[model samples]
Target: MQETPFCLRVGHLLPYSMSDSNTTDFTNPSNFILIGIPGLEIAHVWISIAFCTMYAIAILGNFTILFIVKIEPSLHEPMYYFLCMLAVSDLALSTSTLPKTLSIFWFNSREIDFSACLTQMYFIHCFSAMESGIFVAMALDRYVAICDPLRHSTILTNHVVAKISLAVVLRGCVLVLPTAFLARQWPYCRTNIIPHTYCEHIAVVKLACNDTRVSSYYGLFVVFFVTGLDMLFIAVSYTQILRAIFSLPTKDTRLKTFGTCGSHLCVILAFYIPGLFSFLMQLFGHNVALHFHVLMANIYLLVPPMLNPIIYGVRTRQIRDRLLRLFPHKRI
Candidate 1:
């Protein structure tokens, strides 16, 4: 008989494998139970409708941006490239979490395989980190356009954008990989029911009884430190941009400058504020209602993806004009 590979054996043992009769041992919890928003059980039906709508809008909006960018030759610039990157990141982010989220609300299906939860947690953090990186790239694009218009084309060439995209992807994957490894090391010894709709790094880490501070801190680092670095760069870029905008000769020029950044700023704020709130909830939210944690995490994941396309589609003159031309008879 052929021997099972060591990796395969470990894989089988990884879930529901650890149990001590003296202590609460969930060991390898083969699956995790997701109890959707506590106390709102009866309202899940109504909530499903809303979440489904949000998911639909996010898909439609991001795909529309993709379609529009594909057809419009004039939009093949670094800025639009970054915008496309953002759209792709949003799609990944939303797709990672929302389908499972909606399933719990609609199908009454709540059990997620242990490995599946880990995969979900990894992707959720990975794409979210990519979003942060893309924002920084976008900010840099805006900075170059405003602060050094003459070299903007040369500075953010297609090759450069490709490199940036590659870097963003690598960074996200590399930083978030540790989280899953850390989770794998900690033995779970309690009820495997995760008290939320989706599996996040923090959500899963909180379940382990061991000294989980490392996993929690690493999560915080990914959530706060990585994003903070990106946000810091974005802030610096925008500060330079604002100074350049203010130095312009005319009020019209200043408004135009601000107009160029408005959509991106909106996207930034939409992504970060709820993320910060959710991060806080993970820390201090013990005092607050459990539902608030559920709500904030959903907002952090769901709201930005839903809003980014709408924000850009309306605020961007190029997208607006092309949209108008494409559907001249219909009101956008």
Candidate 2:
């Protein structure tokens, strides 16, 4: 029998090998192959078109929000300040994965360096946590504006907003730091083929050769502790806001109070509902098709960033007027 070629043996031991338990000892692959959507390879080119459009919209819309807030002296208040933070978070979260995902779809460039994957994973989760915190701050801003109108400015002063922004950044970075560290410590002896477009935490951990219970449980803890706790605060704030609104003597007062939160409420639902669904499906939906889960994961990140600016621009009178003003010749 002819001897096996050296290249074939190395290929079998590393990148091209498909066996899950192929490595007997602790080993780490130099890189991973992201297959994009597992069952949708035939349509990757078409999907890339849609992904490109959404990314373009997200980038343009967020930059516009940041610019408008920066230039408009009247918008230099706590509410718009929190809005700027939210816009920045959305930009960062989407950007963390969009480039690699587009590369996979457009050019079949599926290989991602191990360290790069970890960095992408860290930023994606960190910014997601930060975005949740920003939403809570925005909710509090609305609560004070409606419930304690007298002290709205005094309470959420520029000084206080600065503190809140710092807390949001620190909380996300510190909490998510451990997840990346845990992921890095794992020995990825399984097949290096990740069936998703990006290096999601759960997906990456599931490939490790050793017990991953600690990492998995810690990730769940961070999700609930950060996202769950922030959501609870938002709920309490909104409840107070509603109660304060209804106590107002006139119907017009109630309508006006609720109107102030319409954009914020829309944004909250857009960000949280799909996010929760994707998380739950990953944990419990064992029978759910893999492609469906991956698609939802991608959508959970993509849709919110694209929709947030549109929702705020359409529902917020201030942003709408400023956006309109930017184009004098195309006045409508």
Candidate 3:
């Protein structure tokens, strides 16, 4: 033995580093403790307040839209159907991360079981991926409605909508399951503290004793194909949408036609911009601060879910119309 830097004594409960470095041994279950907004542990109490507010609004807003879409017959068209799917995806994404995040920030409860962490990681990525797919699907819906008005109903019928939803859900589940499975199989000999608000796949994988490049690269690949391709296709769809608008005979017609896409366009940009930035930072800026990395990651994951419902409530006419019709009007 050249020199023993960190020693794991037979009965010690905590690991300590005395100055040695070596490969880790991967065996057995390891509990991961999430560190929220790294280097700002003192401010977690305040952070939790903001997060709770976002969560409350996100869940309530999304649930409201879901309720409205479910009961209203007039809004049972394909666009609203896609919107409902979007709401479901947002709810899944938020619920997967926010509750545990609040627990970490408010109660200092961050110890996550190995299996539980794996499950959380799986859902986070899965729901996020699903959300991306839904955006693409929405863009396609708009393209059809705008570019081929007469065929829109025929194309996006109930059967077709159900198939699209199934495809979105299945795509995410199939893609993310492998990463979670491979991650769970990795040997985590030490370093179970995840430097983030939630159990993200890459963050959790870094704790493993084995070489983590495989998971990292695979994660990057999935992101490129899933989120990246979705974005590319959205861009292409919108390009066609713009052409269709310009082809309209009158200016008012063009504006009215494009207005229908505004909410979806906002949602697409909102979701993907931060995601792209976070992913890029991870790829190229290895020297970036851990706190910044964690912050960006949290913003990308949480902001869209919190904001999507609000955007739709304010922007979509059908939703707003139905919402106003929900209450009894008594002029005081």
Candidate 4:
């Protein structure tokens, strides 16, 4: 006897079911496959724990930096202004996905509402663009300090910083708006289950029922434009900075300048290395190796914020001192 599609009706609820023949049924229980390497169960658990820990550290660390900057009158300079911006961006970056990701892992629920998912995607990209813009601004700040020290203060005045901040937010919004809109236009017919813990744009786009070639192209274009071009600018700025430092006759002045840049360099490497590696691995790695790519993606998202405050505090003595003063008598 042919069963009536195995209907599982409840009181006043007509829950639909799929016949065995129907391969694509919205009514069927979501067949979300958790594909990954066999031994990654332990790895996934550890990663989840690490992610939670990093989320806390990132938030606390950035918040502390923000607080110190806000209260410390002496630290009110273009460099510190950029640092504050970066801290805010990191906070937003971590907050955009960490809570949703932690919730999914903690409760073992993969279901995210469509609206919520798109919102997360938008903010994640928005903050990401803002972070890139902030990096560019930081590089410019350093360039001025190193190459044009005589006019550094004059050039990077309060009004200029305000304008740069405004530009960062506006440009980020403009760049990411299309991607978010395009993502929502697609009808999700394939598995609603996102492979990764979060609703990443690429992962979501791959599940679209409609053709996404244009979206993919545009997404890649935006990623390259924002990340690649920004990186190029940073590289050029650092090159000039290095040239200036090397030309300095006094060793002490060179050392001090390098010390100031050390933290920014560390954070930049930490943020970009894992991210670039993940992008490359995703493009070239085999199906079985995709798990590693996913792991890299998780790390790229999680690690930078965890390290940003530590780098900045240790490198900037004023920040470190202010932090100590804030919690006087408490063992740090």
Give the candidate number with the greatest TM-score: 2
Segments in model 4 whose C-alpha atoms lie over 4 Å from true places: 1-45, 329-332
In model 2, which regions exceed 4 Å deviation?
1-26, 329-332
In model 4, the clashing pairs are none
lDDT tens digits by residue: candidate 3, 39-115:
67788888778778888898999999999999899989988888888888888898888889888887889788988
lDDT of each: 0.84, 0.87, 0.83, 0.76
Give the runs in model 3 whose Cα sits over 4 Å from its true position. 1-26
**Winner on TM-score (1 vs 2):** 2
Q: What lDDT, from 0 to 1, does candidate 4 have?
A: 0.76
Clashes of each: 7, 0, 1, 0
Error (Å) of candidate 2 at residue 293 is 0.4
Best by lDDT: 2
TM-score of candidate 1 versus the correct structure, residues matched by position: 0.91
Model 2, 21-89: lDDT tens digits are 433333788888798987788998998898889999999999999998888888899989999999999
For residue 17, model 4's alpha carbon misses the true position, in angstroms, by 17
Model 1, runs deviating above 4 Å: 1-24, 330-332
Name the lDDT of candidate 3. Answer: 0.83
Question: What local lDDT does model 4 show for residue 310?
Answer: 87
- Candidate 1 C-alpha lDDT tens digits along 1-332: 32221111111111222234312445877888787886577898898788888989999999999989989999999889989988999999999988998889989899899999999999999999999999999999999989999999899888999999999989999999999999988887655766688987776776676788888777777776788899899999999999999999999989988999999999999999999888877677666766677878887888899999999999999998988788768558
Worst 10 residues of 1 by lDDT: 5-14
